[model samples]
Every structure is written in structure tokens, then in C-alpha cells.
Target: MSTQVAPTSGSPSRMAQLRQVFFSSPIVAFASLMLLLIVLAAIFAPWVSPYDPTRLAPATRLKPPSELNWLGTDAFGRDLFSRVVYGARISLVVGVGAAVAAVLLGLAVGLIAGFFRALDAILMRVVDGLMAIPNILLAIAIVALSGASLWTVLIAITIPEVPRVVRLVRSVVLSAREEPYVEAAMAAGSSTWRILTRHLLPNTVAPLIVQGTYICASAILIEAILSFLGAGISPETPTWGNIMAEGRIYFQINPGIIFWPGLVLSVTILSINLVGDAVRDALDPRMAKRGIDR
Candidate 1:
């Protein structure tokens, strides 16, 4: 006779459990709210920004914060507030793009490396080599060779992160491959791809979600660093890093030039990281047992 399993909770729905956990954690709640605001601002930059981010007004250069200028003007007399808002959009695009691409590539490689004993040594050696090199140096070399563009920057960021995701997924696959269900699937004439996809893939999803948030945060910081070094997006662009780079020369005239954009960049990264932490706690079985997370 067949049997069915009941839900984990008799009263609270899964969404309710998650909501309870969210409201109970003040730091996570605040971080989530901040992340939401930053995302919304980035998405609505065209409507939210008062001036063309790239438009220059030479006469008003280095203007201080005011009712008219909002966050004030930069060295080039472009609107700082407008540039910051628009910058968020591009920064997020790079962050999310790198996270997704890295995860996909890593998932494929990690599955093969973990499942097939013959390929493990070769794949791991390549991954270890990539990990041995400093990510920033590797990224800079790529940007220098490829020339700066959105696509190039995305590729540079994604390459450095792939090893991390690959390691995470590979470990999960290795452990899961020994499970009874997986062994049974193999014995029952399941294809290697079928066993990997149907049995192993589900185990990685929760961890991948947590890891993706961290990758997004790291990519944002790396992009900013590259831009600050004049190796990322064009100087003409209004990314937070580019803004700070341009203002460094005239910092005495207006510290606000760099300060405001830097603040926004820092807050966005902090929010993403905190959210990732919250997700990790939520997905952990121990935390779930205590009703501390979903």
C-alpha cells in the first residue's frame, strides 16, 4: 500500500512561517527593505533622476548639496544625484548578470566533476588553478585584454566567481551521489544525466540561492573597484566607481562628490550580504527546527 507524508506544520503555512521569521529578525528585515529600495530606485532611474546623468553644466561645477541640485554637481558639473541613481541600474545589471552566468556554468561543470570519478582530477585541477590566482588581478587582466564594455566586464566578473560556485555544487553532488535514492536510480537503469538532473539538482537549489546573493554583492564591489582603477566602464559613464574616481582629484573642493556615491555603493552591498546571510539561516535545517527560519 502507498502512503503519504503530512506537512511539517499543522497550523502555519510555509509563507506564514517565513513571514514570522522575517518580522522577528530586525536586521534582516531592515536589510531586505534597503535592498528593495535600491532595486526600485535602479529600476525607476529614468523617472526618478531630475537631470541627464551625463549632461554637463560647466558653470555650476562643484556645487554643494542644495534644494536645486539635490546631491550637488560633480567636477564636470553633471548632476550627482542623477548619476548615482542611474549608476545603480548599471551596477545591479552587472551584479545580477555575473551571478546568473556563473551559477549556470558552475552547475554544469561541478555536476560532471563530482559525478564522474575519471574527470574529477582534471576538472578540480583547473578550478584550483583559477582559484589560486587573485580574482581582482585576473579580472583586471581580462578587462585590459578585452577592452571595457558591459559584456566584457560581465565576463570578467563571472570567470572569477565560477570556481566558488563549482566547488559548492561539486561538494553537494559528491555527498548526494551516495544517497540510497541516487544508487537506486543508477541500479534501475537510469541514465547518468537523468540521475544527476532528477536526484542531485534539487539538493543544490537552496544553497545556490544563498550563494547567488553573495556573488551579486561581490560582483558589485569588483565592478566598482575596476571602475575606480579606470579599467572598468568608461569614465564618461556615471557608475558609482567612476564618480568616485573623477572626484578624487578635486576632493578638497567637494568631498561630497565621492562620499555620496560611495555611501550608496556601500549600503547596497551591505544589504545584499545581510540578505544572503538571512537566506542561509533560513535554509538551514537546524534554524528551521527552532522556527527561526523557513
Candidate 2:
């Protein structure tokens, strides 16, 4: 005969569950710490930066990392460290702004398409058309048409991401709408709005959240690419992309110019991806069940 384990008050609280999920994967913990430090550095840039990122000094131009200038001065003699810090602000803003916009728009489209069978084909066809175009190329076209600026770049990045998000949400909603609870609500004469909002929307949150993190990470990388290609924010702006663009000319002279900012960007993206993976594993019921079994 087998003995059964009893549920008890010792079971973890919501916060404890989240903590455990975050720490269950060592990569997630390290990534979280790295992201936290980067965010803090970005937030405190104005105070922590030794010098103005954009203020140029010809006398100090091309200076290597030194006591006076931590990451050294760029070709324009602007502080590399300061520029990287300020660039973080731009990247994070674009990433988060684009992700939020895409998720909101995608959720609406997905809900309508998935809930109403009549609209599914047409809506999904449109989503398919959008997805057919390469993401970066679409963003470039949008940015080219709109003219490059912070907002334009954000919109450009967001538009390309929406289709992917919509597909993800639509698939989830399609499966969820057939569930017993959803059918029960439908048979009980629940209003379409109530059924969609009360039942369908809640189920999409976990996957949408996971997708959003990935979108945020993608947006950041896309923004950098756009800026580097001269299709992003103004060159005068001290974004990581523009900084690297400027640094490329002097790479033979001082590789540090490109190295530092590139390192930060890579680290930031990696950290976000790590956290996204952790969140996906945590929110997935199969994964959680497996963990419990283990």
C-alpha cells in the first residue's frame, strides 16, 4: 500500500512561489541581478555619470579609459560610460513601450479573432500577411516612411511585433475557448463581452506576459540596429547604437569605444531572455507539475 501526502498550511504563499520559481533556475537569478543593476545604473545615470554624455571636449578626444574618464572619451570626447548609461534609458524605454503597445493591440485582435469564428479567417489572414514580411525589413520600411525619431522607431518596432503576439494569443484563446467553463458560460447565456473578458482574457495573461518580455528584448535589439543603420533616433542622441556607429570609425584606434557599449547591450539582451525563459517555465502548468513530482 502507498501512503498519500497531505496538503498543509506549510504550503508556500504566492510570493514564496514566485521566489522559488525565480531561484529554481540559477541562470534566472543571475539574470535578474544583472538586469536590476543595469536598470539601477540607468535610473541613476544623471547622478552617477561622471560627465555629460553629449558634452564634447576636443582636448580629451580619443582618450582611453583613465581615472578621469572611466570608460574613456569618444571621438567627440564625450564620456563613453555616461553615454552607455544614458543609452540604457533609451533602450529600456523603447523596449517597454513597444512591448506594451504590441501586447495591447495584439490582445484585442486575438480576442476578437479567437472568440468569433466568423472573423477568424480574415483576421488571421491579415496577421499572416504581416508575418510574411521580415520583421527588420518591415521596421525599416516603416521608419523610412515615418522618418526616424524616437517615437517613429517605437512605432516601427511595435508594428512588426504585433502579428507575432496576436498569433500567440489567438492560439491560446482558441484552445481555451473550447474548455468546459467557457462552454458553460456560453450555454448559460453569458454576454459575449462578459465571456471574453471574464473567461478568455484571464487565461491569456501568462503567455502574453512571457511573449511581452521577448518582445521587449527584441525591440531593444531592433532599436539598436535601426540607430546603427541611421534609421533610428538622431545621431546626436547618445544611444548605444549611435555610439557604436560613431565608434566604428575609430575602432582601429580604440576598440574600447565599441567594446564597452556592445558588452552592455549583449548583457542586457541575454539577461532579459534568461528571465523570459524562467517566467515561461514558471507559468507553464506542465513544468510546475513536473517540478512538484521531482
- Name the top lDDT candidate: 1
Superposed model 2: Cα runs more than 4 Å off? 1-14, 292-294
Q: Per-model C-alpha lDDT, please?
A: 0.91, 0.90
Q: Worst lDDT window (10 residues) for model 2?
A: 285-294
TM-scores, each model vs. reference: 0.96, 0.94
Tens digits of lDDT, candidate 1, 59-168 = 99999999989999998799999999999988999999999999999999999999999999999999999999998999999999999998999999999999999999
lDDT of 2 at 254: 88
lDDT of 1 at 163: 97
Candidate 1 Cα misplacement greater than 4 A, ranges: 1-3, 10-14
Worst 10 residues of 1 by lDDT: 8-17
At residue 99, give the lDDT of candidate 1.
97
lDDT of 2 by residue, 1-294 (tens): 999988666654445556777876677799999999999998999998988888989999999999999999999889899999999999999999999999999999999999889999999999999999998899999989989889999999999899988898899899999999999999999999999999999999989989999999999999999898888999999899999999999999989888998999999999999888877777777766566321
